[model samples]
Target: MRSFFDPRQLAHAPSREFHNGGWSAYAEVPARAEAILAAIGGTERPADHGETPIARVHAAAYLDYLKTAPARWLADGREGDVIGYTWPAVRRRPLRLDRIDALAGWYSIDAATPLTADSWTSAYWSVQSGLSALDAVLAGDRAAFALCRPPGHHAGADYCGGYCHLNTAAIVAQAARDGGVARVAILDIDYHHGNGTQDIFWTRGDVFYASIHADPATDYPFYWGHADEAGEGEGAGTTLNLPLAQGTTLAPFRAAQARALDAIAAFGVEIVVVSFGADTWEGDPISAFRLRTPDYAILAGDIAARGLPCVVLMEGGYAVSALGANVASFLDGF
Candidate 1:
């Protein structure tokens, strides 16, 4: 299978993240991509598809904030990477805020995702990697992988969080629609729910979103990813959330994947965009799933059984040591 990645993806290196009411080393680091590349052998650098394709899913203002916020923060005498402390949780009214702190809070969902100077560049190329992988699938490859770093699944149209700046899966699905795919389904097998991807297509019927992740009641991004939050209006029944328990094992995880695949088949999707995350590994530090390394092949083989063309975009997986083998196992299975 052809794979796409950019060296620039390593540039969005944030120093640390605020987690559990304390500051800690950033879990999402450039070494994550380095480990995957070393295991995957070679990858093609993606061409710059520019902001047009990204604009299909993300808001222009949000994009602008990601691009300029670093410079604005530095100009305002702020030190280190930009992290937001406040958010408009009450009545998020539309208003113009020029302060870097306010803009950071306005455009961010949490304090975990810090914005560095090269964040926009890396995030831009991350989307381009997915687009190029989609190009391969459109050109008749059975499947392709986008080794996107600074994993992007938790980002919404207007906010960035969960170590994600751009919603790569959402952008890729929208791009597939623009490329003439009649129906598309996104299967996010990440440890955490893809709240951003679900939010992006919640009211749209063109793309179907499905995810199997840790139950939001006890996991990160605790507000979204419930069983009852189905799509509304034209996208009704197009969204599926199969939130598993915290120490979930392969048997139940595999069953959830089968149900997600069956739902995709029923939706008549022509292509599947997998938001693959190896963080579900039993040894992962931040995540709490019990999936072992070999189990990835079994899970991936289930997706392969469907026979639909797939464009797999990288998502979260912080166990740097085992990330390579886990990713390799999934690709080998597919």
Candidate 2:
């Protein structure tokens, strides 16, 4: 299996994040990527696919904000990472706002994602890594992995949140469709639900999105990911969400995976995009799943047994010390 990783992804490190009504050290850090790289051995630097693929999923205004927010914050005589403190509750209307704070609020979904000077650079490269992996799969590789940090799955077409700035999985899926793949399926196995990914493809039938994550009723990103959110418009019945309870073990988790895989098979997709996250490991610091390191291999092997080309994109997993082993085990299955 070919794997891609860009060193520039580590440059987007932020000092801290706001969680549970308090400020704390950021759970998503550069060390997370380093650990994975150390375990995985060598990785190729991703080729630059430019901004066209990213723009296919993310909004132009949001991309501009990500690129310029840090400079704008500095120009306002502010220091540290730029974080949004206020957010609009109603529909946003056009307005002339020059303040960086206002722009932050306008473009952000929550305060967990902070914008640093190199965040845009890192995020841009992160997308390239996923695109590079997709390139490998499209070229006839059975599977490929993209080690993306500042893990994306929470960022939508126009907003950043959940320590995610850009929806890399969504972008790759769209790119697959644009590259002539008739049907694509995104299977997100992160501990947390991929709300942004679902939102981006909510009304599209070409790419089916499925996720098995902690129940939103008691976990992060508590709005989407319920079982009832099947899809809307042309995308109806294309989305499958299986919300597991906290402290879920492998038996039930495997059941959920079976259901998701069965649906994807039924959809008859030509390719499968696995939004793989090691946070579901039992030792993960910020997650609730109780899956052990060995369990990942078994779970991933199940997906591999489906005999489909796979493009695996890294997402959330904060147990720094155990992360590498968990990831390696997962890859071993494929």
Candidate 3:
């Protein structure tokens, strides 16, 4: 398997995120890949993987902005994290502007995701890590996990949201499709409903998206995960949302995983891209599900046994302190 990444991922380090009705210091801070290397006791260096040219799946200008706009933000006198504009400002402003800083609000879909001085570079590299893992797959590695930071799953084709900027899962799924896989299935096991993934693949039939998540009505993104929102047009019936009520423990989550795997199996997809996120861990600060550490191993084992070549893209898991162990354990099991 391959772990793809670019050095820029280290550039965007968020100080905190909103939770508990206020902001708390970040729990999952991304240490430098060098630190991860040292912690894992790896003498061998990870191979360099190039930055992913996001235009392969997203808009060209958007990709350009994602690569360069953060500099514009920093250049503007405003410093620190670049957050989204509030309601009236964003919804009301429709005019196109050349100022990259102004464009950040337009490009960013929501307030949760912020572009700091280094957001673009770090995010772009995280995407590169994912793409590199895919390239390794193309080279015949049976499985790979891209362990970069700034987890991406909520980003959309033309929009950024939910702490995600580039939509790595979508990019990889499409990469598989473009690489000649007739059908690619993205099984998002992230705690959130993956509203962006659902939206991206909703009108395309070739891609199948099945998600097991916290029910939208009761969870974070409240309008998109209903069982009835099944894909539209050619994508009709291709989207599956198995939203569980809060307080779901490992057993039920495993059953739901089985259901999703079965559906993907039924779809006969040649490739599987898992939008992996361990944020559902029982102790996670912001999530509602009750999965413990070992459960991730079980889920990984199940996915591996499904017998499809896979690329596991990290989505979200903010307990940075324990995140590495949980993620590495799951990958080892997978």
- TM for every model, in the order presented, reads 0.99, 0.98, 0.88
Instruction: Evaluate model 2: give its TM-score.
Output: 0.98
> What digit string (tens of lDDT, one per residue) describes model 1 on residues 79-118?
9999999999953568889999999999888999999999
lDDT of each residue in 150-199, candidate 2, tens digit only: 78899999999998999999999999999999999999999999999999
Name model 1 segments beyond 4 Å from true.
Answer: none
Q: Candidate 3, after superposition: displacement of residue 151 in Å?
A: 1.2
Cα lDDT of model 3 overall?
0.75
**Model 2 accuracy (lDDT, Cα):** 0.94
For model 3, the stretches where C-alpha displacement exceeds 4 angstroms are 16-21, 26-28, 32-53, 74-76, 87-95, 98-102
RMSD of each: 0.7, 0.9, 3.0
Task: State the weakest 10-residue window (summed lDDT) of model 1.
Answer: 88-97
Whole-structure CA lDDT of model 1: 0.94
Residue 229, candidate 3: alpha-carbon lDDT: 83
